[model samples]
Target: MCEHMRPASAFWSFRENISPSALSVTTDGKHTVVGTQNGLIFLNSRGRPLWFNKKIRKVADVSVSTKSGKIAVGSSQKVLYLVNLKGEPIWHRELDSSVIAVSISSRGNLIVVGTDLGKLILFDGKGKKKWEVHLSNSDFPVNSVDITSDGEFILAGTDYSHLYLYDSNGSVLWSKETGSAVLKTCISSNGDYLGYLTSDCKFSFCVKNSRMLWENTFDSQPLWIDMAQTADFVSIGESSNKVNLYNKSGRKVWGFANESSRMGVMASGGGNVILGNKGGIFNYSLEPYLKRLLTGCKRSIIKATEENLDVTESRKIYDVASKNFSNANFSQFLINIHKARNLAREARVIESDSVPSERRLERNEVEEDPIVPQENTEDEMMAKLVQLAEMREKGILSEEEFIMAKSKLLRI
Candidate 1:
């Protein structure tokens, strides 16, 4: 599982006095909500605290609604609290037993709670009980539960080595008996894929139309597991002090090992992962190449600015790139960084030949009187026009910038 390990660095990390008991992240990787013995914590992508509430005693589990940004908190105190992103409580319920697991739908319209009393309960967003299913008569607690994004399906794993899938109406679709107690379960956003872990050190994935897509046996029991919205990525935190990520093909994408135990692991659609234990919560990016590109773009912009180049557009694009990078939106970050780099190159070209230090053009003057090469062959002029077109196509230049660059290149 560690064979394809790639180097990963945390963009940010946060620590609390108590080890995080539960972790949940949104699909965009913008918000991460953590639960500890002290309370519930809402964190931004940069590991900065948005809000914190210490009223919930001994939080056992937490879940976040990806679409609506609602949070559901389950505590060992036999209480469930529904809170907003601002940490203000919307509702609270005292259950018959301690809550072992909890999950909220993507839209925050439904919720499912797993209790130590062997009861799996479903509730509407408004705190109305929809239904409850008794897993076993012998108090085999439900260890883990997950619901589809639309709240149409629910999956639950129990201490009795039983796994059950049910419809929103509380009718069981199917159930399986694992070799051992099921520790964790995850469902893809569309309910088309399922991933689970059993106490037997087995990790399994199955598709909707299939029995099981693949299974892997680990040397140690995996503590927590999560999947991306599209089912393209899965991640696990193990008792072995390692966190491993797997792609849809069941291939290991990367592995991160640390001295401290991983309390939980979560995967987001934006190629971001968060794993933590007693030490702290750590944010890691799967696409480190984009990070390097962003760094290079920043460097290029700095060099262009130092040469007294009119890099106003480049700086604006670079700021957007930095923000996207901080938010773990690697795809948008890549696009913006490339635009910034292209603009920086063009600025360097204009500054190198057009303006001397003493007679540098004002910002408005530069925009009004676009730089035009004093001497250029027909081929050179065509090449410059093509470059401007490329910049326009890539969103490096605005419509006005494109028109101005074109007019300057062809002397129109």
Candidate 2:
């Protein structure tokens, strides 16, 4: 992928490392809310700090209700806060254990909270408890939870590497095992796609009705995370400070790496992308043309090595010849080089063999013809042409033979 835009000069500087937690954006995209390890809530805009929570004990997760103007924050202190847009607490509730995850329905009428002990609490718009489900056995904790955009299902990730899907009526729909603990998950606006980041640093997105749509495994664990989706693409982030962009077809589009270890924020509006890290917030104009060029280059390298070229000289010839061609023509070049190289290798083997001639061919005749009979003019010329062309293409033929064969072929 091509990075056409440079990092913007705008940036937010934090006094300390951003604690491992979830980050969220308001529905209007005007403000961002993040939870800190020390139970603080921070609201930021354009690399500028807007508000900070002073009294909230270390918040573990936070989510914004797009329709109701409510912000739900969960803490390890076994408390959940329902705050308004101005960051004022509207209500507070205690869970049986430390709250690990929280998500608000799009209409803001419902709030779902997951506890470290694997219990789920559902509250109505007014903070009244509607239902609660305990998933804790002897072995797992509720790692994360997300409600579908249409309020049809509640998706939860567990510490034991499994995902449980529950209908709005609190019925289990389906469950699937992941490679590792699922760290985070996000569903698309239309409710047809779901994306998740795993503890193993692998990101996977799939259609809600089927198996995996696409997955990417990384070398480092992801920290703060968010995803942007379009009809054709999805972009994900890592706490190690990188943004991995992917196509809807499950291909990697490109990636942005941050040199600074600061937490990075990502959001998309209209067609523009906003990236925030320690350096600042930058608005990047998407460049599809340049991205195509880079993606083409990457595909060429992958296709070049897919076939076995060692069995034939043609394969070797095409492999070497294609390097000089334009990136788009590399596949054809590879084929040509392989054919030429194979032929040359066969010719060498034929010439190296020492064999006695048939009794029909006298010693004198064998000496006169060498490899081919001198009297057979057409056959001799064709043999010479093939040899000369092969050698010249391989950079082994003399200038004289190369020119002679060229003249002969042109005359014919």
Candidate 3:
């Protein structure tokens, strides 16, 4: 059963049997598509159902091609069903295992699928296999796959606690270790950032080079996260039945909670945010909520470095405050300022300790040649020195002349 809560002004409700495993609301808001656990497909709006899938098993996931009007449904039986807007199946293909997820490239020419056995398959728009990569052994399952908007690279999240990146030609570029099982991942429309949620329920937003831009941990497992291209913000929905909005800097802006609903934030469009839950579908306007939250006293905590400190001994003194402040808010601010000051003082101490001493010898004084030639040419004198040294071994050279030539060579 599905229940829905639309905007108070719209008063729309959508009812369905067997909970939806996945939901994709069209960009135009003219249609919403849902895939159910019973292997059924439904298309509906505020009023009634427009179409349904005929050959139903469990539908693992669904994707709608905005440009081509093609709806692709992946099934637990390892087959993908492609249909037109009218719910007529156009093509179907079988795979080695169940299809867990699917995504269409921005141009809608390629579709990427993540299989149950950690395989990433690429298919053309006509439902022909382009290439298939077995990312891991059968022990691992791929949870999600995403392609950059420009189709330059592909990213896959695996159950073995790793994320794999592949170039356009299917060459492995790089892989990163994540904290836990990666549940879902999404790339921004502009292809500038990628966001992912781990099994531990933490979210990481990263740039192209794998540098983490921001990371946020939730008290409950995150169900889904989405980003907006025009704004430096992301919306995250957690299993605790709360939706929290975060700025690009990783600060929580606002949060809404619905205790009775097992809800998750899906996609935001046309200033309206869409959410899915056991109760059904819900939409909330963003303008009023964003304005009200931004106007409030929404202070964020940030780590401060020594260069950030303006006052002397600020960090040392702030360390003192950290031990004393009973309130977390006030203590964090003081700690940052103190950290900066302490860093400056330490830098000054190091600079003073690095000063050179005046008693050290000059470069020329430490290296001087002999003051005079002893006997023959410079080479003969060295030969004579060697002969005298050998004679001294046989008791031939006198001690005084040997000392004299040695002193001359030593410039003594």
- List of clashing residue pairs for candidate 1: none
Best by lDDT: 1
Overall lDDT per candidate, in order of appearance = 0.75, 0.57, 0.58
Instruction: Estimate the Cα RMSD of every predicted model relative to the unseen true structure.
Output: 14.8, 20.0, 24.0
The weakest ten consecutive residues by lDDT in model 3 span 358-367
Q: Judge candidate 1 at residue 35 and give its lDDT.
A: 90
Look at candidate 2 and tell me the lDDT of residue 39.
50
lDDT of 2 by residue, 195-277 (tens): 77788888876666535655667667765444443223455655444555554444444555543444433432212234444
TM-score quality measure for candidate 2: 0.61
Measure candidate 2: CA RMSD. Answer: 20.0
The runs of at least 3 residues in candidate 1 whose Cα sits more than 4 Å from the true structure, single-residue gaps closed, are: 289-412
Residue range 62-97, candidate 1, lDDT tens digits: 899867868999988998889998999999998889
Backbone atom clashes (below 3 Å) for every candidate: 0, 23, 6
What's model 3's lDDT at 282?
53
Candidate 1 positional error at 2, Å? 8.0
lDDT of 3 by residue, 1-412 (tens): 1122222332244644447677665544446667776655554555356867657568877777656787778888899878777888888899989999887665667778899888888887789888888885554888887766456777788898888777667777778889799888876654556788899979987765566766778777877876653234577776536666655445455556544334343332323345555646555444443333222211101111322423335444454444433222222322343344334433432333322111011101111111111233453344334433543444433576456545554452
Taking all chains together, each candidate's TM-score versus the true structure is 0.69, 0.61, 0.64
Q: What is the lDDT of residue 37 in candidate 3?
A: 67
